[model samples]
Target: AQSVTQPDARVTVSEGASLQLRCKYSYSATPYLFWYVQYPRQGLQLLLKYYSGDPVVQGVNGFEAEFSKSNSSFHLRKASVHWSDSAVYFCAVSAGNTGNYKYVFGAGTRLKVIA
Candidate 1:
């Protein structure tokens, strides 16, 4: 069984400050990992994903994530954040075969960017 843990339930930062959201996973094998952001009433938007190849993957809105196999972690980072970037961010893991996959999500971390 694969599971994700987002330690922080909420995070607050200055409008232009750098941010890092921690995510840890437990899985038997290396699974597909993803970061999604959800606005107030919108659907989940794919920020980035890591299946294979590069350890670090770039995402939309100047966001990126680095996957560490040994650490069993995939942490999201942003060089600088904007006020609009404040939202609920979720870390998810997908396992099983190509078509038949199951997704496990973390308790989202709500970000509040203040000026």
Candidate 2:
């Protein structure tokens, strides 16, 4: 079975501080990993995805992630965060050939940025 675990349920950081969101996954075959950010009342938007190529993938909004097969983890990072970044961040994964492409979202880590 494939699954994802986010160590933190909520994270609070001051504006302009660096942020790191941890994510761990379990899967048989090589998995397709994704990071998505959802603002309040809005749908999810893809932050980054790693399939085969580069171990590090970059996404919009100044977010990036690194894929590690050995550790089975893909953690998201940002150099600096803004109040606007205060939303739910989700780590998603799909095994092998990407099912439904619909994504299995993590329980989501709520980020609260203080100014």
Candidate 3:
């Protein structure tokens, strides 16, 4: 069975500070990892993803993630975060090869940015 874990339930950071949201996954084979952000009352939006190739991939905004097979992790990072970046961050994993490409999402980590 595949699973996703986000150790932190919530994180508070000062505005303009660097941010790193940890994510870990468990899967037998290569996994399609993704990072998504959900606003208060909006759908989850893709922040970054790692399918294949380069371990590090750039995403929208100043976000980026590095995939580590040995660690079974795909952590998201940002050089500087703004107040608007406050949201619930979710780490998800999907095994496309499996008969059912169902995605398992982590509990979620709420980010609070303060001035």
Each candidate: RMSD to true structure?
Answer: 1.3, 1.6, 0.7
lDDT of 3 by residue, 3-115 (tens): 99999999999999999999999999999999999999899999888889999999998999999999999999999999999999999999977786689999999999999
State the weakest 10-residue window (summed lDDT) of model 3: 94-103
The best candidate in terms of lDDT: 1
Query: What's the lDDT of the predicted structure labeled candidate 2?
Result: 0.90
Per-prediction TM-score: 0.96, 0.93, 0.97
Count of steric clashes across candidates, in order: 0, 0, 0
In TM-score terms, candidate 2 sits at 0.93
Error of 3 at 115 (Å): 0.7
How does each model score on lDDT?
0.96, 0.90, 0.94
Q: For model 3, what is the C-alpha lDDT against the true structure?
A: 0.94
> What number of backbone clashes does candidate 2 have, counting pairs of residues 3 or more apart or in separate chains?
0
Candidate 3 C-alpha RMSD relative to the actual structure:
0.7
Worst 10 residues of 2 by lDDT: 96-105
